[model samples]
Target: LPATVTIDQPAVLTASAAGDDVTCYNAANGTITVSSPTGGSGEFEFRINGGTWQEGLVFSNLAPDTYTIDIRDKNNPLCIVTLPETVTIDQPAVLSASAAGDDVTCFNAANGKITVSSPTGGSGEYEFRINGGTWQEGLVFSNLAPDTYTIDIRDKNTPACIVTLPGTVTIDQPAVLSASAAGDDVTCYNAANGKITVSSPTGGSGEYEFRINGGT
Candidate 1:
């Protein structure tokens, strides 16, 4: 008769995720690549979010959320490893815009201005545009024409989060001025007191003033 003996060893595994913690709008996709297992000889298997085990060393097309990566040795089911890693996804930014300045004022005067309120979201500066024009810093729009305009706001860190708003500005011309004098140029100086009358100025309201020799 021959004697038989059995020996067993535990399995060990380690893995590292590729890329940063948060997936920005223009950043690369999140992924996890597992290294070869140690202390055992068996095929490697992986599973994400507690899903079915897959035959591969790398996982792709992952979203922003907490994930559970399970690694096990097919030869020895008891020898397994589990890792919990969180994948973060940035949220879209919210932007608000407002219009200011005179709407109905004197002609050739500065038109209404458009301003953008502070936005909430990722860090970095913000860009603005008016009437589908070029993008620029600051949220102010000056010397705008008296017409409707389109406003746009976007984050410098990410281009995916852009906000659009509709706006309008109006301007009016100043009133015209005209005056006439009702009196004869040649009047008998010493003959019966000469009479002179002044007509009210045109396009003027509130109060009227008559003066001679630039005096009030």
Candidate 2:
């Protein structure tokens, strides 16, 4: 006898026939299509990932992962079988990271922060690192010393996807100061204050009494 097939709504493979006489296969890539001795007129219920049942159809758009198919005999409900099938849905997501300024300079200080973002919507988790250090989530940094650093980012998946970027920070030195003085009774002096003021009528470039102060 021709084995009959029946499926519930949502179109999942609920149950099918067992014995060697009954056979089924996914006719298309990323889909599950089942056929039996029973004709098309036989209604079948189908569902995806154990979800609500719906009319059985040839194709469906399911999430990227493994799935199972169940089939049953519409004419003889007593004859039922569950078939296991794996459906691979392709969902390629892209990740990227960048800084507001490609390069920066700090005068005896480290002040540079990078901003990171992902264009893809389904990015589960994100991580970043500096100069191959520990991976950090959110791709952020603070109080970094003056040096060249590399930033790497990755997504949280079976096979993690990673991306790297290069950046630099330079430190500068402070300014210097000089002073001089002259006369028979003239006295050279250095001030503890930040500013140095001189009161002299002879403004010539000669070896005169001199003093220095106000800087480290």
Candidate 3:
């Protein structure tokens, strides 16, 4: 008579993965398939961020953030491995702007101007728009018309981030004109070159051209 002994081999698990690396687009969305524990000794379980374990090894629709994934054998929970990764999602840039100069009283008066300083959080490139018109380069808006206007600003890098200031650029109406002479309104006719002097115009640039008796 002979005695025979049988030995059972310990179970070994193995996993493999091949795909696009995690990024702002992919968002660490991928899968890991286990090919060990032959003969279907047990099923695969997975978890993320220390959450409740779930069946399967596929992850998707993840947002921008850090994540910790662990895969284990359902039959032997102790047999597990953790994979740490981070996902980044691009953020829209920010913009800040300030204005300079003041309202003008006449068309020839100094026009108001706006200048955009260094951006706070977003890209430095900036653009300006007037009356919701076409976008233009640079931060300064000069030689503007003499009327209420809407000023819009945005980050060139991300147009979605924008700010609008209503009636920001305004030019006051032209001031009335008046003329005065050094002496009385009437002058001696045929007098030796009657002296005529004009005073500075009010509420205007002080420059003026007047016609006497409908003549130059």
Candidate 4:
């Protein structure tokens, strides 16, 4: 029986004929169906990594590594072979943004800034935008008003895809003064008399003070 096997990636193996002069090669992860030449009683032995030969079908779960296999016929002791090969597996490309996580909360503030970083060690240019506005490289924003903003980050290498991050900003009004200070510490000017009157209230200090433009 003669059979051909297909494997994943690249690897090597050896096949030899035993009694019935049956040979096999390239028995990879693919299918390996054997057929007797005369359709008569024939048996073959298959071994991997120089281990004991198994009298059955062999399937390979090829990982990101290499392997070796040997096949022989049991009926013929003169049939023996050895094969060596190498396999290669490439890594997948990945791009990600580290700026936004699960949630983004903000307090009372007029302006805000957010920074975006790349985790994959690939060094390349990047662009960032808010609410689908103009894109800016380096993923840096400044003087952003208080509101909910949708951010988009894109890698220059792969412009077709973009990463998005949502953020929020808030602003609060300033506090105001309510009541006046104690008098005569507080005085009023009388334009008719061309004079200022300072009246000291009861249980208050008698000290007199004057100021122009809120200055002494």
For all predicted structures, in order, the TM-scores are 0.57, 0.37, 0.49, 0.34
TM-score for predicted model 3 compared with the true structure:
0.49
Candidate 2 at 40: error in angstroms?
A: 20
Q: Rank the candidates by TM-score, best first.
A: 1, 3, 2, 4
lDDT value, residue 162 of candidate 1: 66
What TM-score number comes out for model 4? 0.34
| lDDT for each residue of candidate 3 in 1-216, tens digit (9 for 90 to 100) | 498888884455444422222322223333333223232246777666687787755555444445565667777888776643432334333345555535555655665555544444446566778778889877676766566667777767666657774336555646755656564444576566555676755655677777667997
Best-performing candidate as measured by TM-score: 1
lDDT of 4 by residue, 1-216 (tens): 499888653122244222111111111223232222221124556655565677754433322223354556566544654433322322223344566422222233344555566634213556777778888875566555445567676656546546564453222222221223432323445434343453432221333345546886
The true-versus-predicted C-alpha distance at residue 89 of model 3, in Å, is 4.2
lDDT of each: 0.59, 0.47, 0.56, 0.44
Ranked by lDDT, the better of candidates 2 and 4 is 2
Q: Candidate 3 lDDT (Cα, whole model)?
A: 0.56
What does candidate 1's lDDT look like per residue over 1-216, in tens digits?
Answer: 498787865555655444233334433355665555444466767777677787676776555555667776767666667754543433333455554434424334455565656544544667778767888877677665456666776676665556675554333334445578776555565666555687867653435677766886
Question: Pairing residues by index, what is the TM-score of model 2?
Answer: 0.37
What range of 10 consecutive residues in model 3 has the weakest lDDT sum? 17-26
Q: Which stretches of candidate 1 lie over 4 Å from their true place?
A: 1-4, 18-45, 50-61, 72-81, 84-104, 107-110, 165-216
